[model samples]
Target: MNYNTENLDDKRLVALYKKMLLPRLIEEKMLILLRQGKISKWFSGIGQEAIAVGVTMALNDDEYILPMHRNLGIFTTRNIPLNRLFSQWQGKASGFTKGRDRSFHFGSQEHKIVGMISHLGPQLGVADGIALASKLKHKNQVTAVFTGEGGTSEGDFHEALNVASVWQLPVLFCIENNGYGLSTPTKEQYNCEHLADRAVGYGMEAHIIDGNNIIEVYTKVQELAESIRNNPRPVLIEFKTFRMRGHEESSGTDYVPKALFETWETKDPIANFEQFLLTENILSADNIEEIKIKYTKNINDNLELSFNESKIESSEIKELNDVFNIIENEIITHSSEEKEFRFIDAISEGLKQCMERHDDLIIMGQDIAEYGGVFKITEGFLEQFGKERIRNTPICESAIIEVAMGLSIAGMKSVVEMQFADFISSGFNPVVNLLAKSYYRWGQQADVVIRMPCGGGVGAGPFHSQTNEAWFTKTPGLKVVYPAFPYDAKGLLASAVNDPNPVLFFEHKGLYRSIREDVPTDYYTLPLGKASVLKDGTEITVISYGMGLHWVLETLKQYPEISVDVIDLRTLQPLDTETMFNSVKKTGKAIILQEDSLFGSLSSEISALIMENCFEYLDAPVKRVGSLDTPIPFAKALEDQYLGESRFEAALKSLLAY
Candidate 1:
């Protein structure tokens, strides 16, 4: 095909050739290493180099690009150090993630590279966050996210695209329409004629280009990128490409038809581009040989040098005390003012104070803007903070949660309000896998506080009335806070927002308007992983949090003769073991209580901790008090029986008699 080269200069063409050539050479060496059992696995981008190179070359140095596992050209194009890149592939301690995450499932904040999460769709939302940050910062920088044709079927992809289009975010969704998603053909993937056609439903501009044509990709993408930077709207570009290899080296290409490979082999990006360079007289055939020889040697040398770096010998446990340093800009009002507040009001006051202090802090969720949340937590936030800071998103819990992680990548903080604690299940993957594991896996701090309105009493039933703090408490790298009183709620929330890790802040919906205390109107931070002794006694130590603590205190008032040490575990993740242990040691008897069901509840873990740490001091076997092991019922009568006063009274008698 005769090409248009009036706008493509010679110097730029050679630079593009080198970028594309380097990855080609690197992959060639690495695949050899894979077969030799040197590198454990390889996800080769042998055929799809043009897309990564073209998209990366067009972006500004500071602009972020989230690339998939197959997009090796991106790392090479961005000049990521070959030694470390090789080290990462080899799982060495010197690698980007220091052997914490496997393969290219790692992000490099230094190089403006947000690598793909193994689950392909979530990164699209992350790209939205980076682009939103650019828009908020008024940088006008574009963020380009890459995905295959199969990834387009993911809910996150659709959610992210809708959000980007709705907000007109400067994001370029690059869909490399590779023929198959693993062994499954595109025929089974989507019914659409073209993947780019899906973008029209999202109200975004769509473009289709020949993926094997390097000149077409570079020139066209550069134009679209420049256009988005100027106008600041999303554009999805479908690069019609083919993956020449199987999903990975282990998976053979037997499923692929012979005709497809023959067709794609003729349109090989490197062969065609090299022919174009040769035909244009841009460089001699000797120059092409020299470029390949130079990088091929460089790739071998880097691979050899990287082998000298030791693999991760021993796995290190994540440090719980590695707290995020919150740089306070403005001091809170000095006046000593304490006012009566309900649990809901304290949360509102605390968030308001935090927003006032941190100008860049954003709060995102569904209907959180005009509706002020179902419980009215963010009643006037949209008006006070404006639309940008207080964002109302589509029903995209999975993507929006990672969107907070993306904000953290851009050095911003966010609070994601899950309408109900049960709804958090929708956004659970990013919390457990992506956001929660980020710091441990890659030293990337995702400073996000997820507001969870939890617990049962008002008969909201199985979905809304869940005491699910136990779900996150066991997950490493996440802080869980459940404050019983308004004072603790306000103070703990401030600390949660300021903390450098992801925190699950549980608020009992029953306690929201019912529980009242004198909470300070001024900003204050209650340190997490610290316990407060509400009452000191000698007979027994009862460690509890949230509604369970309230039940303990109330029940204790009725049992006047049975003096007990009442402890409120303000934070669930970093259990204040010191306080709980000392109390149990002093009292010589213990009981762990929680509103969750008995089996696999946080109460059982506390019982284990007491038995392990203070077994000798125990006057009797450590007792656990929890709600009945059954799903929260809808009927008020059944719920009352399930969480009845008799259940706790009986447990107290059994422990006391022992």
Candidate 2:
């Protein structure tokens, strides 16, 4: 269906034509820079400017947007300084990234633009989160997410759509069907003829539009945005357009068929829109010339300004050092009077206190709301708070984690539960890519907490009984905490919640219900990098945490001859090197123990820390005691043999002999 430009006013049609021209000019210049070796590589939205500008103009300025790498048109139209865009492409210090993030990872919170994530399709989930936050905050705003047709084939796209549909979130998912996914055509990527058709499975409003027709693109998006704002439901719009150039500047155009290029070139969105403007008499020849001249001058001025601007000083790094400095100038505001609470109760109370402090804080997972979580840690939360605060999500691990990351990015504190510790693998991508690297990449904090019931001892088979603390400890920018008792659990959880980073808080399934201890009633926080000395001795230093602390306590009682100093390294990311070194210095020997496998375990990290810091101080080589390389066995006898306790006994005997 063709859209007639005759219905629209001359000024609006001319403005649309100008917007389409801007991206083409910017992209044409960028291509020149690329060929001249001034820029490394880039993906240009040359022929697809109408789709970007139309969709962006359709939404309000207060609304949020998450765009993919090839979304320069949207960013440019949204007033992302053209010079910064050019600088980013040139890899200069004055670039949008400041040499830290990639060129396309641009965003401005002031402009209500959430940063773009590089991964395909995950932005849809982020859009959902932003929309949810808007709803909760009582803001009349929609979140529009842009991605390629190729992204629709990803599991994240389906998962995101399913979540948005279930929650009836206000999100506009725009798919730019640019024909090729880095040389592979859409027909080779998916079975569907139109990408918008796939949205029917999620029961969402779906439409396919001629992306080249600026009026049609704008009208459809405006209507959809209004529908979502009123009813707050997910909408999917597929824009059929084509890329005028190869996928990136570095890629050769040989892979694409000449016939396909010829066919698509005739249907170029910018060229078609320009022709429409002229035929409808919406833009005079003089007006077109004036607009080109104005844009050229503006682009040149921006380029000159950015080039001459002072580079982001490396000395400015210290200014950003305290960005996540949670402990800085913190007043110990806890009341002197304290009340008693159990470990499970403390976990629940800590969450409640945090939620009360931060209105943006949300807790969600399976059985989390009414059931109060699997272990009743979140019991009475739904009754005390509303369903919005304490949510019960479907048993979709990947969806839960991705949504948490999305919410966190949208300025919300999300605490997610992995019903079982072993189930965290399902949400590993969001944890690793979105959560762990977000701060480092885009200077945005992913302040999220993943509470998992970890460890073994109770008969929860191999599937349910695994201490996978090492899996996250190995990832940088992720803080892993294992609290032995209720007091520490409450304090550490409070600290993690207050921290401006992602934290993995592992609550041992064995200790959650079995172990009970007195916890402070008021809000109190523990230092993240500090360790606690459970017991002091001279001969050997036993470095352990979580369930291993119990074994260390028991072993010390049995072996009077082995004067062991037990140190609980609370936070794994910034391990207490000073404490570990001092303890090892006094003891002259070290033993690391944990319930996980020795290969690629937290024990290895502890051992490395010891060797790196106080190798000469060590009288004997640092020994590690952990589970066998094989998976945890089902039988009690086999499980006991496979875990760290047996190895701990053997290591202690070996250290005594040494």
Candidate 3:
């Protein structure tokens, strides 16, 4: 309330004026274009420009921002050329997303602007990540994220707030209280007096500002951004405003009371600020008109140029880096220098080596640091790497994943361990939607690996024991790696760390300590998307991964006469078709084993692929053996039958007879 504009010289005031006006003018022209069938759609930020413009102007140039679609001022204030901004709106290949996504669904890494998704809450979580990277890198940076009043209702909003506070992350959460989210009023959204009031429970500082007052917004946000950098912590600001138009132009504002709209119109941010400039004798009538004409011509020229640009073609949409680009590193050649390592030890060594090689590599999870995680895989890692690299997190799965993405954006690689693979359900959205689609949508490589400790037989029951690799294999844009042996586990993990894409690395808890083998003592890596022929023969081929591979090998010991070619599929996503088909062609029969249930599993897809491509080479129909189609039970008797040795024996017997 005590903020003043006297200290802001005429030059700075005029610059702020231009920033607020450009977005309004561009959106006005965009509205005309939408009706003329030139642009496909539009979101108007007519009255709410001050909140976006003021806040963006308040931050340092190097600080990152994540803004929603309605924040046109954030784009305009950043000085993104009108032509290029229009080009993006017009779906031109010259735009930030290269016409991959229209509107604000794409991020511009060059501009330090992270994009928004349809689901608003997750972006708030993603902001926590960028802030974490800044803190970890020892940079004087703060991340600002925006959302509407309704967005606070989501669990992700609360989860992110709690994580940022608990970790003391430097994140400035800005909420634009635009009265309504689509059609629902703020009253219907929550019972709190103000959205900022919710910050009390999280122990986060809160502030409410007159959003329509540009001077107040700029002053308060600038102060907070500076204070937060000096003493890092999370803070929330509720900017009170109302949208002049509907959520989108097409959805008219019939739900808004006419009286309320008229009242807000009188307090219009741009108009009030202009009147202040006039009252202060900073601008005359002619000067104001000249400014409008200058901007109008600029807007017109950009719009015409954008309309002339060509649309993006499908062929130009290829991703720059291959998702499963296997690093051509030397394989384990030191046979005599090898040492016996448990499956868990191999994983730990792989991560340790990767972290040592890539200085920016970070690992995060609940109880991962100090406690060394529940399985003790990262034991003594905290003392070795320090808390900055080996970070611990709250039970905010959603936020932790987003932080990994933020690290990726900050030129760092990360490994996120899901304490239990089944717990991924709590934070699955960002993994599937944000991290997986990041590169495909905007060419931002999500250089992160998610470690999923999964599989049954440990009696952890349904919530802990799960083979979720199938879920990711079905989702394009993610690499799924499941290794059976300790050697493969270490090598495949190193390859995953090398991959510049999102990888789901599944480590079967049942094998973490139960399985041990001679692994290379020196640093080495093996290629992903390549299956190892453990035992090759001509009678029949058996394919499997993770615990299923171990089960197949153990059951085959009973029948030595059965000449079977056993294949361990190291990476499930980019299936090694060449090796699988070559082995199947010679054997003339195949049986796929999996720890996951039969239906809609990786086995189904692999079987389908084999039937489609290798029909001529097949002597009998391809068979699949998997756990029972039911939730994994805690009872020992039921779990034994579910993943029984009899199932593997039956499949081998049936395939060999063919």
Candidate 4:
């Protein structure tokens, strides 16, 4: 430890010692609770307390700290009330997540501490977004993220560091190399001696510190933090320490050699740092003992209070609806003097309007910069918004979505473009597991718009042409929007940008240039979850969206005698049941059409919905039309046959005949 006692004043030294002491005491008490079967799981940073506490001390009060499960000590330094922390673990109503999570899975928004993703690596990218936000706002605050040695193996770690380095965002990547990632030793995890060595690959400043020495950890972090806040760049610091306990209380120590465990036990961060304070004459033995007693009493009292609080009942949990808060702006209809726009042009114009309205709206995706997007949806965006708001990201899907979630946490709305909807399969984890569950779990909503260019007919094989809306429609928290006209695309996208929850806005490849409408030159937002009736008739009702709506319209044109009523369900999720049921009840027959595969299709869901609500009004059985179960073939003939208009016409005829 290069830090001298004279460098830190007596008061600062004492504060540092106490900060490290609280987490250690809390960890010891948590183990006791674990044995009594009071807590569900326990992951302690016993010997790594210095890393969490020291970094917390170094960061500015307003700076964000994204902490992993093991870094619970940071909550103490952040001054998050002890009762709230205990209440979370105790599954009580007053916890950050209102008893939704059973462990250290919640973050304090007031304290600028974001809750961690269980898969710790994603938080690194999230921190990158936080840092990006600070830089964008020109705020003098850096973001510090914590992770374990084992976490480096995850791909997001590399992705985050690369993005941070490329942008020169002020981010501090703290890796607590505590010998093992769960049971796997450091030697088995990576070939490098120090995790900091990997930082060079990402063009980040690297530092290695003795994590057991509190003074060393704090002094080094403080020095790096000062530089980061001023110059704004990422710095990776590896804190070498050991975990005193096995992965959890029950994991057993047999996997770790007894001698190895004993050696680290002697070098325990809390006791070692406490002895150093006494040696330096910074604290008396009585003072050190009093501090421990004071914190222990505080923790125990909180534990009691948390246990006495009411558990979150099912009804109470249900009160936290899918989306937390909807920032519903008044609808400003497009005036009569509006201009006509192509579907793709309307999308770009809508985003431009959003960016013009809110400074916090950011656009991110691959090739979305000076090169514009491959489809040129973001053409001229770079010149209009500049690079800070318009980011050209690497082809890393999961990290792109995760980083957007982080920006949303920092009070910014992000619009992420997936080059093709099929490519979203590469980033399914964050979208389905994290992004979808965020609001329901902790009342945190990431105001993000994922723009997916989807559907077949352009002859861009299976990967490029896909209608994946059904996947998100099945998910609980997501809102799926697919517009068939330019006006709907522009208006719905405006609504999606203003929407407080995550929205999957699907733009069909076929309709990008082919569809045109008199879109309002002025800003206008269409109501989400409200179906638009394109035509009204009496014989049969056709329900469709995206490119399929065009097919339904064309098929209706050929059969003018059939008297078909057409409904465009602009939003798949939160589907407009009233309009759909009313139309079906009037016609007494329904034909559901979609571009996705027939098995488990969106049409299948609507079929079930119709049977459940409008069965009595039906004069004929409902029919569904869609592509074959096979993957979208590259051959134009086969692809045309797969989604041929004849198939759609046949389904409509069959339903009408029955």
Candidate 5:
């Protein structure tokens, strides 16, 4: 169906035409910069301006927008300073991320615009979480998320739509069907007829529209945004358009067919809108030319201003020290009496206390609501905090993690639970790529803790029983915490909740009920990177964490004569080098133990550290002990053999003899 410009009032028609022209001109200028080598890269929204500008203009000023990399028109429509946009492209300190990120990789909290990631699909789930927050607060605001036709095929796209539909969230999923995903056409990308048809499977409202028509995009998006704001439901609108240029400046359009490219050139949204304005007499040709000249001048002036902005100073390039934002000296809670608390209860209590203390704290996991989680770690939380705070999400790990990142960006402290640490592989992309990089790149506080029930020994086998702390330990900008006792579990969890960076809190399932400790009755916090010397010895030093620490302690009972100094590395990322080095320096011998595979494990990292720091002090070569190099066995006998006390006993004897 053709969208008539006559349907819009004169003022609205003029405004839409100008909005379409502004970004087109800016992109044209950016192309010149790209050729001149003034800009590093450019992703143009040349022919698809109407879709981004129309939807952005239709939404309320306070409403949130999650724009993809190509949605440059959103920046113009939202009035993001053109100079700042240019500064980001130029990698100047004046940019939103202080020269840390380029392109649409940086978000503006002041403008209520969340930036996009290259992965593209994860942000859709994050937008769902933002919409969920708005709905819970009764803000009557709608979050509009932009993605391409290719993004619809992603697993996260399916996860986001399913959750939004299940919860009836206030979300506007604006998909720009630009005919191609980078270089592949829609026919080769998906089997579906229209991308909008896939939304029906999720029980979401779906529509298809002529993306070149400004009036159609604006009117339809405006009406749908209003409906979702009032009714709180997700609607998917697919705008059919084409990208006139290649994916980026460096990626040439040699892959495109000549006839197809020529066809889209005539259908340029800006030119089509301009022609409509002139034919309808809503805007005179001279007046439209003046608008074009004005925008051209505006773009050039902003480019000059951005070039003048100061470069990032060397002094400003500080280390990533805020990985764990902890309050050191403050006694959060003081009590003389101690109560015996189980490890699982301590974890639940830490979450409860954090939620009660901070109104912004939220918990999300599968079966966490009425079912209280598969392991009952969140039992009775649904009744206490209500469903709004304790959300039971679908078993989509990527979506769950991405949603948590969104909540964190919105200044909410989120705690996500993985039923088994092994399942973290499903959510690995968002955690390692987005959550770990947020703080270092843009200084955004990823105030989130992913509770991972890890370690083997349970008959659950490989898929469920596994220690994955080593994966995160190797990653920068993330803190890895594993507490062997209930005291550390409760205190460290409280600290993880308060930390401004993302934390992976590993809780060994075997230690959940097998051990108990005298936990402080009142709320308190422990330092994230601090290590506790559980036992002091002069002969040998054994460094371990989680269930591995427990095995070390138990193994020492058989050898009563061995004075082994057992150190629990509560936090793995910032390994307590001082404590471990000092112990090894005193003992002149070291042993590392982990529940992960022996090769390339956390023990390997610790052994390397020992070699580097205490080479001269060591009387013998350091030893490492861990599970066998294979997937956890399903059979009880093989599993025990794979992870048994004999392994630690043998390693300790070898180290002692050496």
Candidate 6:
């Protein structure tokens, strides 16, 4: 059990011991704060401090780090202020997120930390992405990502590891095998005896270490970190450690047996290291006492100072707005005479133009390069823009999105395509945790565009036919754009490509080849939050988007007497409320229509917005027309029944009658 620290100086050994002690003390302090009602509940990183500190110390300062929630030791050793961490626990203004995030959600770009994304194994893909970028940019920096053993089962982990191994990315995939994930142990989570063994399947070099032993953990990590930096190849390291506390501050320890607790307590990494230092004559008892007193005094003084600091003012609402700063006056100008173009062609041209204007923009997806994408919209792009700019990605949706997020964070504008909108669920974590919440959590901007071919009318069945715009619309800090026409498609897509935030660009599969109008060959940009009034009428206001707009237009042609004012909600998140309310107030009636299911769709939100703003002006109650609450059937007759053009007409007629 006696591990030699002969290679390390006395000062270095003491430093390693100090690093392990910080998280232990911080965890104890956090528990006390939680009990006293000063801080909110959170997971404690008590027994696993050795692994966190040792692995972090192995990496260079310029390298990137993506830590999970149970990475307090890593954050503490990296010199994150104790008071700011405390403020985060308290959900106070002085916290890293300024009260917008939970405790343990730490991120700091200044320290080369890419932030902790909480959705389990997805961080591995993100780490690979950062490493890929570092390689592409020729930066001598590796990306180290930490996760739990439970994360290994996710498809994202396998996909990312495979890609990293194939591409030889400079990444260190560290799994904190802390025996348990919430209530389930590793045996219950994975079938393999050792999690590190799984890495071999992906062609990655795997390592297994005693995570409780600081010396062993540090030595193994140092060797791997050097190999990764020298060869720039991805490696997976599984650190077998134990959780000294429950999963989180709110978790009950009843599930853990008393005997197991006593056993782990005796093998406490912090106490064991202290004893080892004393027995080896590296540190006397007096030195141990002096080190503890110094750290305690430092933590206590910083905590008191942070607590005494004045809280953020309520009137400073503008501070939150400062997080998103749009570079104004960069708008591109276009001629008033708009020429017609097909929706697919417009989308293709928009991306080509964006890539030409901004060198940082890169496009990738299934069949995007040689095949020019599934729809052939990207035809000739690979030739014109080179393979680097218009690259083809494997059929890995999760890895594709994770790469886009990482590239965006590294100052590249990435346009990632999900072959079909329905498959977006595979990459939901990157879109939600990293893309949508990047600016809000870590103060980092993600200028990434996710182009998905959505909507159903071609009988593609449930798998290929879907409108998941509602999913992204429901999440804040993201822009969702569904253009109805070719001009809007070109303009809106151009705008989205240039915007500083993450955008979900939904290109209706039905509209892509079916619709065409006069779109200008020259470059143009449209305002993202603005909606266009297609046909102005006074009888009733119809709010619709994407393929639903076509249905409404056709219905208007059939019923000339209805005299409807149609408003196209081009952008869903920053909804054109002014135009929407004005149209409703002028008509005194509104109808919201979409192709998505009626339950919790964007149509419901449109109805609520109308009712909230134009309730008094309404001549009748607002109505919504959408697909029935059922899956899109494979049969033509069933599909028609589920989603019909007549349904929109009926809703409009009902609104007009009222």
Measured by lDDT, the strongest candidate is 3
Lowest lDDT 10-residue stretch of candidate 5: 322-331
Alpha-carbon shift of residue 70 in model 2 (angstroms): 1.7
Could you tell me the lDDT of residue 589 within candidate 6? 90
Per-prediction TM-score: 0.97, 0.95, 0.97, 0.97, 0.96, 0.92
Q: Write the per-residue lDDT of candidate 5 for residues 517-632, one digit (tens) a residue.
A: 88888889888789999889899999998888888888888888988789999999778899999999999999888888888788888899899999999999999888889999
Model 6 lDDT tens row, 1-658: 4566768888888899999997887778778878988776868788888888998888887777888887787788788888887777666777887777786665687677766666777777778777877877788677898888888878888888887887788888889898888989777999888998988788888889888889898888888887777788988889888887789878877788789889888777889989988998989999888988888888888789778877655445665464454566256878777656789989988888988888878898888998999999889998998877787887788888888878876777889988999998988888887788878776778888999898888999999999899898888778899999999999899999898898999999999888989888889899898999999899888889999889988878888877778999899977889999999899999888888998998888888988998899998998889998998988888889999565887777667776
- Taking every candidate in turn, the Cα RMSD to the unseen true structure, in Å, is 2.0, 2.3, 1.9, 1.7, 2.0, 2.7
Model 2 regions more than 4 Å off: 306-341
Task: Give me candidate 3's TM-score against the actual structure.
Answer: 0.97
Model 2, position 374, has a per-residue lDDT of: 79
Per-residue lDDT tens digits of candidate 3, residues 361-391?
8999989998999999899889989988998
Q: Per model, state how many residue pairs clash.
A: 0, 0, 1, 0, 0, 7
Off by over 4 Å in 3: 1-3, 316-336
Which ranges of candidate 5 are over 4 A from the true structure?
1-8, 310-317, 322-331
Local distance difference test, per candidate? Answer: 0.87, 0.80, 0.87, 0.86, 0.86, 0.83
Writing each residue's lDDT as its tens digit, candidate 2 over 1-658 gives: 2556555677777777777788888878777767877667777777788888898888888788887776766777788778777777655666655666666875677566666666776567777778888888877778998889888888778888888898888888889998889989888999977899888888988999998788899888887888778878888989988887878867767888899889988887767777777777776788789988999889889878766766555655653552343345242456666666666777888888888887889998899888888788888888878999898887777777877877776778889999998998877787877777766555667778999898888877788999998788777668889998888888888888888788999988887776777666788888888899988889999898888888888877887776778899877777788888999999999998888889988888779888998988989999998888988888899888888886687788899679
Show the lowest summed lDDT stretch of 10 residues, model 3.
316-325
Candidate 6 stretches with Cα past 4 Å from truth are: 2-7, 249-267, 279-281, 310-329, 335-340, 558-563, 650-654
Question: Between the candidate structures 1 and 4, which one is better when assessed by lDDT?
Answer: 1
